[model samples]
Target: MFKIGELAELAGVSKRTIDYYTQLGLLEPVRSETNYRYYPEESIERLRLIDALKKQHLTLEEIKERLQIIQNQPDAADEIVDKIEHLQEEMKHIQEELLELKPLLKQLNEQQIKLMTKPLAQQGYTLLHTLAILLGGDPFIN
Candidate 1:
Protein backbone atom coordinates (compact mmCIF):
# COMPACT_ATOMS: atom_id res chain seq x y z
CA MET A 1 0.00 0.00 0.00
CA PHE A 2 1.18 3.51 -0.78
CA LYS A 3 0.26 6.86 0.66
CA ILE A 4 -1.33 9.41 -1.61
CA GLY A 5 1.93 11.19 -2.34
CA GLU A 6 3.73 7.90 -2.87
CA LEU A 7 1.05 6.76 -5.31
CA ALA A 8 1.20 10.06 -7.10
CA GLU A 9 4.96 9.75 -7.47
CA LEU A 10 4.81 6.18 -8.73
CA ALA A 11 1.94 7.01 -11.09
CA GLY A 12 3.63 10.18 -12.29
CA VAL A 13 0.66 12.31 -11.34
CA SER A 14 0.10 14.97 -8.71
CA LYS A 15 -1.36 14.20 -5.29
CA ARG A 16 -4.22 16.49 -6.14
CA THR A 17 -4.87 14.56 -9.32
CA ILE A 18 -5.05 11.31 -7.42
CA ASP A 19 -7.33 12.93 -4.93
CA TYR A 20 -9.53 14.18 -7.72
CA TYR A 21 -9.62 10.77 -9.34
CA THR A 22 -10.48 9.19 -6.03
CA GLN A 23 -13.29 11.66 -5.54
CA LEU A 24 -14.53 10.94 -9.06
CA GLY A 25 -14.61 7.20 -8.24
CA LEU A 26 -11.76 6.48 -10.62
CA LEU A 27 -9.44 5.37 -7.85
CA GLU A 28 -10.24 3.82 -4.52
CA PRO A 29 -7.88 4.44 -1.67
CA VAL A 30 -7.99 2.59 1.58
CA ARG A 31 -8.19 4.73 4.66
CA SER A 32 -5.74 3.79 7.32
CA GLU A 33 -6.51 4.05 11.03
CA THR A 34 -4.38 7.17 11.23
CA ASN A 35 -6.65 8.77 8.59
CA TYR A 36 -4.24 8.56 5.70
CA ARG A 37 -5.26 7.16 2.32
CA TYR A 38 -3.29 4.33 0.90
CA TYR A 39 -3.52 3.09 -2.67
CA PRO A 40 -2.81 -0.41 -3.79
CA GLU A 41 -0.11 -1.35 -6.28
CA GLU A 42 -2.80 -1.75 -8.92
CA SER A 43 -3.41 1.98 -8.88
CA ILE A 44 -0.26 2.53 -10.94
CA GLU A 45 -1.60 0.56 -13.85
CA ARG A 46 -5.01 2.14 -13.41
CA LEU A 47 -3.42 5.55 -13.74
CA ARG A 48 -1.63 4.43 -16.88
CA LEU A 49 -4.91 3.20 -18.37
CA ILE A 50 -6.55 6.51 -17.56
CA ASP A 51 -3.68 8.37 -19.21
CA ALA A 52 -3.83 6.25 -22.34
CA LEU A 53 -7.59 6.68 -22.69
CA LYS A 54 -7.27 10.43 -22.14
CA LYS A 55 -4.70 10.55 -24.96
CA GLN A 56 -7.32 9.00 -27.25
CA HIS A 57 -9.57 12.03 -26.70
CA LEU A 58 -12.11 10.35 -24.45
CA THR A 59 -13.78 12.60 -21.93
CA LEU A 60 -13.30 11.94 -18.23
CA GLU A 61 -16.91 10.82 -18.06
CA GLU A 62 -16.38 8.38 -20.89
CA ILE A 63 -13.26 7.05 -19.21
CA LYS A 64 -15.20 6.59 -15.98
CA GLU A 65 -17.94 4.74 -17.84
CA ARG A 66 -15.42 2.45 -19.51
CA LEU A 67 -13.71 1.82 -16.20
CA GLN A 68 -17.05 1.02 -14.57
CA ILE A 69 -17.85 -1.47 -17.29
CA ILE A 70 -14.53 -3.20 -16.85
CA GLN A 71 -14.76 -3.27 -13.05
CA ASN A 72 -18.35 -4.46 -13.09
CA GLN A 73 -17.50 -7.59 -15.00
CA PRO A 74 -17.63 -10.66 -12.73
CA ASP A 75 -14.54 -12.37 -14.05
CA ALA A 76 -10.92 -11.44 -14.64
CA ALA A 77 -11.30 -7.68 -14.32
CA ASP A 78 -7.56 -7.06 -14.35
CA GLU A 79 -7.08 -9.24 -17.39
CA ILE A 80 -9.96 -7.56 -19.17
CA VAL A 81 -8.69 -4.08 -18.35
CA ASP A 82 -5.23 -5.06 -19.58
CA LYS A 83 -6.67 -6.32 -22.85
CA ILE A 84 -8.77 -3.19 -23.30
CA GLU A 85 -5.75 -0.96 -22.66
CA HIS A 86 -3.87 -2.97 -25.24
CA LEU A 87 -6.76 -2.65 -27.69
CA GLN A 88 -6.88 1.10 -27.17
CA GLU A 89 -3.14 1.39 -27.80
CA GLU A 90 -3.54 -0.63 -30.99
CA MET A 91 -6.51 1.49 -32.06
CA LYS A 92 -4.47 4.66 -31.58
CA HIS A 93 -1.96 3.38 -34.11
CA ILE A 94 -4.70 2.32 -36.48
CA GLN A 95 -6.39 5.69 -36.07
CA GLU A 96 -3.17 7.42 -37.09
CA GLU A 97 -2.86 5.24 -40.18
CA LEU A 98 -6.49 5.88 -41.06
CA LEU A 99 -5.95 9.62 -40.70
CA GLU A 100 -3.11 9.36 -43.18
CA LEU A 101 -5.56 7.74 -45.57
CA LYS A 102 -8.40 10.15 -44.82
CA PRO A 103 -7.39 12.62 -47.54
CA LEU A 104 -7.38 9.91 -50.18
CA LEU A 105 -10.65 8.56 -48.81
CA LYS A 106 -12.33 11.96 -48.98
CA GLN A 107 -11.40 12.17 -52.66
CA LEU A 108 -13.61 9.15 -53.37
CA ASN A 109 -17.26 9.84 -54.21
CA GLU A 110 -20.14 7.75 -52.85
CA GLN A 111 -19.93 5.06 -55.50
CA GLN A 112 -16.16 4.79 -55.25
CA ILE A 113 -16.30 4.59 -51.47
CA LYS A 114 -18.99 1.94 -51.67
CA LEU A 115 -16.91 -0.10 -54.07
CA MET A 116 -13.97 0.15 -51.73
CA THR A 117 -15.95 -0.83 -48.63
CA LYS A 118 -18.15 -3.50 -50.16
CA PRO A 119 -15.57 -6.22 -49.66
CA LEU A 120 -14.86 -5.02 -46.12
CA ALA A 121 -18.59 -4.85 -45.38
CA GLN A 122 -19.01 -8.31 -46.86
CA GLN A 123 -16.46 -9.70 -44.49
CA GLY A 124 -18.75 -8.79 -41.57
CA TYR A 125 -21.05 -6.00 -40.44
CA THR A 126 -19.97 -6.70 -36.88
CA LEU A 127 -16.37 -6.10 -37.84
CA LEU A 128 -17.20 -2.67 -39.21
CA HIS A 129 -19.22 -1.75 -36.15
CA THR A 130 -16.49 -2.95 -33.83
CA LEU A 131 -13.87 -1.01 -35.73
CA ALA A 132 -16.01 2.11 -35.70
CA ILE A 133 -16.55 1.95 -31.96
CA LEU A 134 -12.92 1.20 -31.23
CA LEU A 135 -11.83 4.04 -33.46
CA GLY A 136 -14.37 6.38 -31.83
CA GLY A 137 -16.01 7.15 -35.16
CA ASP A 138 -19.55 7.45 -36.41
CA PRO A 139 -20.69 4.06 -37.66
CA PHE A 140 -23.02 5.72 -40.17
CA ILE A 141 -21.01 8.76 -41.20
CA ASN A 142 -22.45 10.73 -44.10
Candidate 2:
Protein backbone atom coordinates (compact mmCIF):
# COMPACT_ATOMS: atom_id res chain seq x y z
CA MET A 1 0.00 0.00 0.00
CA PHE A 2 1.11 3.55 -0.77
CA LYS A 3 0.48 6.60 1.35
CA ILE A 4 -1.69 9.40 0.03
CA GLY A 5 1.35 11.49 -0.91
CA GLU A 6 2.99 8.57 -2.69
CA LEU A 7 -0.19 7.76 -4.58
CA ALA A 8 -0.63 11.40 -5.53
CA GLU A 9 2.93 11.49 -6.89
CA LEU A 10 2.40 8.27 -8.76
CA ALA A 11 -0.88 9.51 -10.20
CA GLY A 12 0.52 12.95 -11.07
CA VAL A 13 -2.32 14.70 -9.21
CA SER A 14 -2.46 16.50 -5.90
CA LYS A 15 -3.44 14.74 -2.69
CA ARG A 16 -6.49 16.98 -2.51
CA THR A 17 -7.67 15.77 -5.90
CA ILE A 18 -7.23 12.19 -4.75
CA ASP A 19 -9.14 12.96 -1.58
CA TYR A 20 -11.92 14.46 -3.68
CA TYR A 21 -11.98 11.32 -5.80
CA THR A 22 -12.30 9.25 -2.64
CA GLN A 23 -15.15 11.44 -1.45
CA LEU A 24 -16.90 10.88 -4.76
CA GLY A 25 -16.40 7.10 -4.31
CA LEU A 26 -14.34 7.01 -7.45
CA LEU A 27 -11.47 5.58 -5.41
CA GLU A 28 -11.67 3.52 -2.23
CA PRO A 29 -8.34 4.01 -0.55
CA VAL A 30 -8.09 2.51 2.93
CA ARG A 31 -7.51 4.55 6.08
CA SER A 32 -5.01 3.75 8.79
CA GLU A 33 -5.70 4.09 12.53
CA THR A 34 -4.48 7.67 12.41
CA ASN A 35 -6.87 8.26 9.48
CA TYR A 36 -4.14 8.52 6.87
CA ARG A 37 -5.13 7.37 3.40
CA TYR A 38 -3.44 4.45 1.68
CA TYR A 39 -4.01 3.22 -1.84
CA PRO A 40 -3.21 -0.01 -3.57
CA GLU A 41 -1.49 -0.35 -6.97
CA GLU A 42 -4.83 -1.00 -8.66
CA SER A 43 -6.05 2.35 -7.39
CA ILE A 44 -3.41 4.03 -9.50
CA GLU A 45 -4.93 2.53 -12.64
CA ARG A 46 -8.36 3.69 -11.55
CA LEU A 47 -7.03 7.21 -11.00
CA ARG A 48 -5.51 7.19 -14.49
CA LEU A 49 -8.79 6.06 -16.00
CA ILE A 50 -10.76 8.71 -14.13
CA ASP A 51 -8.34 11.37 -15.31
CA ALA A 52 -8.74 10.22 -18.92
CA LEU A 53 -12.52 10.29 -18.65
CA LYS A 54 -12.47 13.79 -17.14
CA LYS A 55 -10.37 14.96 -20.08
CA GLN A 56 -13.34 14.10 -22.29
CA HIS A 57 -15.31 16.71 -20.21
CA LEU A 58 -17.74 14.18 -18.79
CA THR A 59 -19.21 15.13 -15.41
CA LEU A 60 -18.38 13.01 -12.35
CA GLU A 61 -22.07 12.04 -12.13
CA GLU A 62 -22.03 11.00 -15.77
CA ILE A 63 -18.92 8.93 -15.17
CA LYS A 64 -20.50 7.26 -12.17
CA GLU A 65 -23.66 6.55 -14.14
CA ARG A 66 -21.61 5.01 -16.94
CA LEU A 67 -19.61 2.93 -14.48
CA GLN A 68 -22.78 1.65 -12.85
CA ILE A 69 -24.27 0.79 -16.23
CA ILE A 70 -21.06 -0.98 -17.20
CA GLN A 71 -21.04 -2.95 -13.95
CA ASN A 72 -24.66 -4.07 -14.33
CA GLN A 73 -24.22 -5.16 -17.94
CA PRO A 74 -23.06 -8.66 -18.95
CA ASP A 75 -21.70 -7.67 -22.36
CA ALA A 76 -19.68 -4.57 -21.52
CA ALA A 77 -17.91 -4.54 -24.86
CA ASP A 78 -21.16 -4.48 -26.82
CA GLU A 79 -22.70 -1.83 -24.55
CA ILE A 80 -19.67 0.43 -24.99
CA VAL A 81 -19.89 -0.03 -28.76
CA ASP A 82 -23.57 0.83 -28.73
CA LYS A 83 -22.87 4.01 -26.77
CA ILE A 84 -20.16 4.94 -29.26
CA GLU A 85 -22.56 4.39 -32.14
CA HIS A 86 -25.14 6.63 -30.50
CA LEU A 87 -22.53 9.37 -30.01
CA GLN A 88 -21.60 9.01 -33.69
CA GLU A 89 -25.23 9.51 -34.66
CA GLU A 90 -25.39 12.65 -32.51
CA MET A 91 -22.26 13.95 -34.24
CA LYS A 92 -23.80 13.19 -37.61
CA HIS A 93 -26.91 15.18 -36.68
CA ILE A 94 -24.79 18.22 -35.78
CA GLN A 95 -22.95 17.89 -39.07
CA GLU A 96 -26.23 17.77 -40.92
CA GLU A 97 -27.35 20.98 -39.19
CA LEU A 98 -24.13 22.68 -40.32
CA LEU A 99 -24.65 21.40 -43.85
CA GLU A 100 -28.21 22.68 -43.85
CA LEU A 101 -26.81 26.15 -43.20
CA LYS A 102 -25.21 26.01 -46.64
CA PRO A 103 -27.66 28.42 -48.22
CA LEU A 104 -26.51 31.22 -45.90
CA LEU A 105 -22.94 30.10 -46.57
CA LYS A 106 -23.51 30.43 -50.31
CA GLN A 107 -24.88 33.91 -49.87
CA LEU A 108 -21.84 34.80 -47.78
CA ASN A 109 -19.59 33.41 -50.52
CA GLU A 110 -21.30 35.57 -53.11
CA GLN A 111 -20.79 38.61 -50.90
CA GLN A 112 -17.12 37.69 -50.53
CA ILE A 113 -16.79 37.46 -54.32
CA LYS A 114 -18.37 40.87 -54.70
CA LEU A 115 -16.00 42.30 -52.10
CA MET A 116 -12.97 40.79 -53.85
CA THR A 117 -13.70 42.81 -56.99
CA LYS A 118 -14.10 46.02 -54.96
CA PRO A 119 -11.32 48.36 -53.70
CA LEU A 120 -8.84 47.06 -51.05
CA ALA A 121 -10.33 49.18 -48.21
CA GLN A 122 -13.78 47.68 -48.90
CA GLN A 123 -12.42 44.13 -48.82
CA GLY A 124 -11.43 44.46 -45.15
CA TYR A 125 -14.96 45.42 -44.10
CA THR A 126 -16.47 42.63 -46.14
CA LEU A 127 -14.05 40.11 -44.64
CA LEU A 128 -15.03 41.31 -41.16
CA HIS A 129 -18.70 40.94 -42.04
CA THR A 130 -18.11 37.41 -43.34
CA LEU A 131 -16.27 36.48 -40.15
CA ALA A 132 -19.07 37.97 -38.04
CA ILE A 133 -21.61 35.90 -39.94
CA LEU A 134 -19.60 32.71 -39.67
CA LEU A 135 -18.57 32.98 -36.01
CA GLY A 136 -20.17 35.84 -34.11
CA GLY A 137 -23.80 34.87 -33.48
CA ASP A 138 -25.54 31.57 -33.02
CA PRO A 139 -27.24 30.55 -36.30
CA PHE A 140 -30.48 30.25 -34.40
CA ILE A 141 -29.98 33.34 -32.28
CA ASN A 142 -32.58 36.08 -32.28
Candidate 3:
Protein backbone atom coordinates (compact mmCIF):
# COMPACT_ATOMS: atom_id res chain seq x y z
CA MET A 1 0.00 0.00 0.00
CA PHE A 2 1.79 3.06 -1.29
CA LYS A 3 0.53 6.63 -1.41
CA ILE A 4 0.45 8.65 -4.63
CA GLY A 5 3.63 10.52 -3.81
CA GLU A 6 5.47 7.31 -2.92
CA LEU A 7 4.37 5.64 -6.12
CA ALA A 8 5.32 8.71 -8.12
CA GLU A 9 8.79 8.73 -6.59
CA LEU A 10 9.24 4.98 -6.97
CA ALA A 11 8.06 4.99 -10.57
CA GLY A 12 10.12 8.09 -11.45
CA VAL A 13 7.06 10.13 -12.45
CA SER A 14 5.26 13.11 -11.00
CA LYS A 15 2.08 13.05 -8.92
CA ARG A 16 0.36 15.05 -11.64
CA THR A 17 1.23 12.39 -14.23
CA ILE A 18 -0.24 9.66 -12.02
CA ASP A 19 -3.31 11.79 -11.46
CA TYR A 20 -3.65 12.29 -15.20
CA TYR A 21 -3.47 8.51 -15.72
CA THR A 22 -6.23 8.08 -13.16
CA GLN A 23 -8.26 10.81 -14.83
CA LEU A 24 -7.73 9.13 -18.22
CA GLY A 25 -8.98 5.84 -16.70
CA LEU A 26 -5.61 4.24 -17.39
CA LEU A 27 -4.96 3.34 -13.74
CA GLU A 28 -7.46 2.56 -11.00
CA PRO A 29 -5.76 3.25 -7.69
CA VAL A 30 -7.74 2.86 -4.49
CA ARG A 31 -8.74 5.81 -2.31
CA SER A 32 -8.37 6.11 1.46
CA GLU A 33 -11.04 7.43 3.79
CA THR A 34 -9.39 10.84 3.54
CA ASN A 35 -9.83 10.55 -0.26
CA TYR A 36 -6.15 10.17 -0.97
CA ARG A 37 -5.03 7.84 -3.77
CA TYR A 38 -3.14 4.70 -2.88
CA TYR A 39 -1.49 2.32 -5.34
CA PRO A 40 -0.84 -1.33 -4.80
CA GLU A 41 2.23 -3.30 -5.89
CA GLU A 42 0.54 -4.30 -9.15
CA SER A 43 0.06 -0.64 -10.01
CA ILE A 44 3.78 -0.10 -9.83
CA GLU A 45 4.45 -2.53 -12.71
CA ARG A 46 1.52 -1.12 -14.65
CA LEU A 47 2.97 2.36 -14.25
CA ARG A 48 6.32 1.11 -15.52
CA LEU A 49 4.66 -0.41 -18.58
CA ILE A 50 2.68 2.77 -19.19
CA ASP A 51 5.84 4.82 -18.98
CA ALA A 52 7.57 2.46 -21.44
CA LEU A 53 4.70 2.72 -23.92
CA LYS A 54 4.77 6.53 -23.65
CA LYS A 55 8.49 6.35 -24.47
CA GLN A 56 7.53 4.46 -27.64
CA HIS A 57 5.16 7.33 -28.53
CA LEU A 58 2.04 5.24 -28.04
CA THR A 59 -1.17 7.17 -27.55
CA LEU A 60 -3.28 6.58 -24.43
CA GLU A 61 -6.02 5.11 -26.59
CA GLU A 62 -3.57 2.65 -28.17
CA ILE A 63 -2.33 1.61 -24.73
CA LYS A 64 -5.90 1.14 -23.55
CA GLU A 65 -6.61 -1.01 -26.60
CA ARG A 66 -3.58 -3.16 -25.86
CA LEU A 67 -4.75 -3.57 -22.26
CA GLN A 68 -8.16 -4.58 -23.53
CA ILE A 69 -6.58 -7.09 -25.90
CA ILE A 70 -4.63 -8.67 -23.06
CA GLN A 71 -7.75 -8.89 -20.93
CA ASN A 72 -9.91 -10.36 -23.66
CA GLN A 73 -7.37 -12.90 -24.91
CA PRO A 74 -7.37 -16.34 -23.32
CA ASP A 75 -3.77 -17.18 -24.31
CA ALA A 76 -1.64 -14.07 -24.04
CA ALA A 77 1.43 -16.25 -24.48
CA ASP A 78 0.30 -16.90 -28.05
CA GLU A 79 1.30 -13.36 -28.94
CA ILE A 80 4.72 -13.95 -27.39
CA VAL A 81 5.13 -17.16 -29.36
CA ASP A 82 4.20 -15.41 -32.59
CA LYS A 83 6.71 -12.66 -31.85
CA ILE A 84 9.37 -15.29 -31.11
CA GLU A 85 8.70 -17.00 -34.43
CA HIS A 86 8.90 -13.68 -36.28
CA LEU A 87 12.15 -12.84 -34.50
CA GLN A 88 13.57 -16.25 -35.41
CA GLU A 89 12.83 -15.62 -39.06
CA GLU A 90 14.43 -12.21 -38.82
CA MET A 91 17.44 -13.74 -37.09
CA LYS A 92 17.87 -16.21 -39.94
CA HIS A 93 17.88 -13.34 -42.45
CA ILE A 94 20.35 -11.39 -40.29
CA GLN A 95 22.69 -14.38 -40.20
CA GLU A 96 22.54 -14.64 -43.97
CA GLU A 97 23.27 -10.90 -44.21
CA LEU A 98 26.27 -11.28 -41.91
CA LEU A 99 27.63 -14.13 -43.99
CA GLU A 100 27.28 -12.01 -47.11
CA LEU A 101 28.91 -9.02 -45.42
CA LYS A 102 31.90 -11.03 -44.13
CA PRO A 103 33.81 -10.93 -47.44
CA LEU A 104 33.17 -7.19 -47.84
CA LEU A 105 34.33 -6.58 -44.28
CA LYS A 106 37.49 -8.59 -44.90
CA GLN A 107 38.21 -6.65 -48.08
CA LEU A 108 37.63 -3.33 -46.27
CA ASN A 109 39.98 -4.45 -43.47
CA GLU A 110 42.64 -5.32 -46.04
CA GLN A 111 42.16 -1.90 -47.62
CA GLN A 112 42.63 -0.26 -44.20
CA ILE A 113 45.85 -2.25 -43.55
CA LYS A 114 47.17 -1.30 -47.00
CA LEU A 115 46.32 2.36 -46.37
CA MET A 116 48.07 2.28 -42.99
CA THR A 117 51.28 0.87 -44.58
CA LYS A 118 51.17 3.33 -47.49
CA PRO A 119 52.93 6.69 -47.42
CA LEU A 120 50.79 9.59 -46.27
CA ALA A 121 51.23 11.33 -49.66
CA GLN A 122 49.71 8.30 -51.54
CA GLN A 123 46.55 7.97 -49.36
CA GLY A 124 44.55 10.70 -51.10
CA TYR A 125 42.78 8.73 -53.91
CA THR A 126 41.05 5.87 -52.05
CA LEU A 127 37.38 5.77 -53.18
CA LEU A 128 35.10 3.70 -50.90
CA HIS A 129 31.87 3.71 -52.92
CA THR A 130 29.07 1.42 -51.78
CA LEU A 131 27.43 -1.46 -53.71
CA ALA A 132 24.28 0.62 -54.14
CA ILE A 133 25.21 1.32 -57.75
CA LEU A 134 24.50 -2.34 -58.55
CA LEU A 135 20.80 -1.52 -58.15
CA GLY A 136 21.14 1.69 -60.20
CA GLY A 137 20.54 3.83 -57.10
CA ASP A 138 17.42 3.96 -54.90
CA PRO A 139 14.08 4.90 -56.35
CA PHE A 140 13.90 7.86 -53.97
CA ILE A 141 17.34 9.07 -54.97
CA ASN A 142 16.94 11.89 -57.48
49-119: candidate 1 lDDT, tens digit per residue:
78877876788888988888767773655675577688777768977977887789899998998988687
The alpha-carbon root-mean-square deviation between model 1 and the true structure, to one decimal in Å, is 5.1
Error of 2 at 64 (Å): 2.1
Which runs in model 2 stand beyond 4 Å of their true positions? 69-142
- Per-candidate alpha-carbon RMSD to the true structure: 5.1, 12.3, 12.5
Question: Model 2, residue 140: displacement in angstroms?
Answer: 17
Q: How close is candidate 2 to the true structure, as a TM-score?
A: 0.48
Full-model lDDT, candidate 3: 0.66
RMSD of 3: 12.5
TM for every model, in the order presented, reads 0.62, 0.48, 0.51
Ranking by TM-score: 1, 3, 2
State, as a TM-score between 0 and 1, how close model 3 is to the true structure. 0.51
Error of 1 at 10 (Å): 0.9
Q: What residue pairs clash in candidate 3, if any at all?
A: none
